[model samples]
Target: MQDFTRRATFGLGAAALAGRAFAQTAPPGGIPRAETPPFAVTPEPGASLRIIRPARFVEPDETIFRANAQRFQDKFNVPVRVDFVGWEDIRPQTAVVANTGTGPDVVIGWSDDPHIYAEKVVELSDVAEYLGKRYGGWAFLAEKYGKRHNTETWIGIPIGGNMGPCVYRASAVKEAGFERIPEDHDGFLKLCLAMKKNNKPIGFALGNAVGDGNAFAQWLLWSHGAYLVDEEGKVAINSKETVEALQYLQALYPAFAAGTLSWLDPSNNRAFSAQEIFLTSNGVSLYFTLKNDPGTRAIAEDTQHALMPKGRATVAPQTSTVMNAMVFRHTRYPKAAKAFLAFMMESEQYEPWMQGSLGYWAHPLKAYAASTVWTADPKNTVFRDAMENRFWSGYRGPISQASGAVAADYVLVQMCAAVASGQATPEAAAREAERRAKRYYRNT
Candidate 1:
């Protein structure tokens, strides 16, 4: 496995080039003429495809994505069907397909999923490499998620990322005596405390939500300079760093809205919509939900987005839902599956789909940083660097089956919940998390 420390440096360099836009032109519904490389794969005689992926949070995201799928079908004369399930169900459904080998030919899943089923998925090095070179190369985290642990072999094509930023009410924050959300840990904690005292509490998911819950738990751990494992892949969750994280959570939990222990992916969204909470961490969907409704226009106007506060860690400890497209080896139409993926990633389709998403899905390729979506609205700008700022699921370690299992099992969420809910002390919670994490990393 490549050392993630070095990868971080490379990622910063790629991020620096994000603002330099590529100027390639393409005919309608065709690949860019100047950068186009011949995709020579032929579909099978009776080609058909089925794909399973997480449902969209924004309506336009679904509308544009389905339209792109139809475009592929129309061009290729092949049948295509796509199934959209809840975010929490994607992993289990993909697992079923991997185990039975009789379900969808393509599975678009979250972070570390390709690593978990690496052997069961077909290599897509051609598709990935072609797209990277055609666009301005893949972002650092995207390349890391798509490739196998220790080699350049591609197991998936990174589609994009679902950025989970700290979406808050600017008015409420200002009312709490802060001009803006704080960028440092100490100041942020004070802001949260003031919000709670003012009866405008913050909320974050602590339940088993696959997206928001894991994102928050992982950030809390990482921001405090703790990790599930070290760069060497040894279990490292029981250290003082972890206990300090839990201790921090203990101090912060009282400032959260009541019943946050049971909050799921939609909980904060619902709470914020009803004015039950003033601040929370969420996707742009939360803001769009308000903007699209006439009754909540005021709330939408007051909404603001920011990256999570940096902690003791050198880099921002933000995590996101990375979407990856992988073809199963059991597919009857491997070529067709790969071709469809390539078609969807083409700028003609991808750019519009990204624009329609309204910043809910951030681009994984460096070229997209210059897309109009980022500049379309001032609030949308923070998500523009989500791919550059995000840390992979298993930070400081190689992404492997063990890392996938640990995330899927919700070890970090459970640990945070235990301490925040007073079911366990920080020390006990860290030790328990260590024990559970070791069980998964033991063999790997």
Candidate 2:
């Protein structure tokens, strides 16, 4: 067992570099450091823990995650090796690594990875229990993604997730004759049509953005009370609700900016910042970026955030960007890997580390949501709510490897893209999505 002390200082060069493009979102106040008494772990005599994660584009996040890792490595004399894979490559790369049983001992993953690679990873029940007891219980959706279906076994340790609030130009919205942003499907549709008539259309990507595109498609479908699978995990992509969703998209397609079909994760962000579109579904990154730059600060000030408009269902957004830490079954240093995770989640480290990202990341625990970061800014509070309202791509169904497969295949995005491009009718597109989902489910 060993005790660790919090490092009073963390570098912010990365955040400064990244924040230059967006207004700083971290609360101006500071957090008091807390001490962790002790914890036991059996260190592998000659082995080091290797961690692979998506390299964060935000400067602060890059600094926080990596600096802490290095500090942990130095303090315990347990060398930690970290490899940052790109966002586009992480899932498939992880699958390949997991399949071969040869890669990092620990990994920071996104989406439904816990289910996708359940057999290849170690059960993280111990870490989950510890964190839950130490820092209230894990969030509902966090637990949802980490646990194995119909079992209490945890597939990974939930750390954090991102929110996809509708970031829009409030002034532009007002200029279009709306006093406030619409809260329902009908009003939203009218607003978009108005904006299009004004030559300032809303932008929603119809491309293969693993995070943004997936969220866009799921948010629209779920808003209309449609789901890709039934509650029992059966294929159910073709329904009145789904057809309605597709038809809505078909109607809304011409209102979007050109080049939406070719969009990746960065497209909407770029388009929004460049003022090519007035509104889009994205994380806080774009809003923050607009705020930071003098050239776009006015747009940032005129910016207002909202949850996805309600359709026939609830007025919630289904966030797809989740972050988790997994310890692989092949690790020769399981104890060390768990210890590393334990260190990161401690209140003193976790709070400030998250703060560095300036509200770019959301809390996985209920307790941390009370932090000033969410309270200091109204927009932060709105963005943070996206975490609570989250539903992954396989909503109303089990988040199995099959659902993960569907996402990895970009099935939903492609289906929506087909109809948006007029290559397939709403019914035809819905049927195609259903067929593809069935194939993935059947193989799984």
**CA-lDDT, candidates in order:** 0.82, 0.76
Show pairs that collide, candidate 1.
none
For candidate 1, write residues 1-444 as lDDT tens digits: 101010011111222223112111222222233366567676777899988777777666665677677767768888878777777788888899899988999999988899999989999999988888877888878888989988999998888887788889898899889988787778999999999999899999999877889989988988888888878898888999999999999999989999888977878888999888988888888887888888898989989988888888776688778888999999999999999998888777787777766767888878888787788798989888877765778777889989999999999999999999999999999999988998889853
TM-score of each: 0.91, 0.90
lDDT of 1: 0.82
Candidate with maximal lDDT:
1
Error of 2 at 152 (Å): 1.6
Worst 10 residues of 2 by lDDT: 1-10
Tens-digit lDDT string for candidate 2 (40-108)? 564666658878776664545656666666656656778876666666677877887788998888888
lDDT of 2 at 141: 76
**Per-residue error at 29 for model 2, in Å?**
7.8
C-alpha lDDT of residue 274 in model 2: 82
Q: How accurate is candidate 2 locally (lDDT)?
A: 0.76
- Runs of candidate 2 exceeding 4 Å displacement: 1-39
Q: Among all windows of ten consecutive residues in candidate 1, which has the lowest summed lDDT?
A: 1-10
True lDDT of residue 412, candidate 2: 88
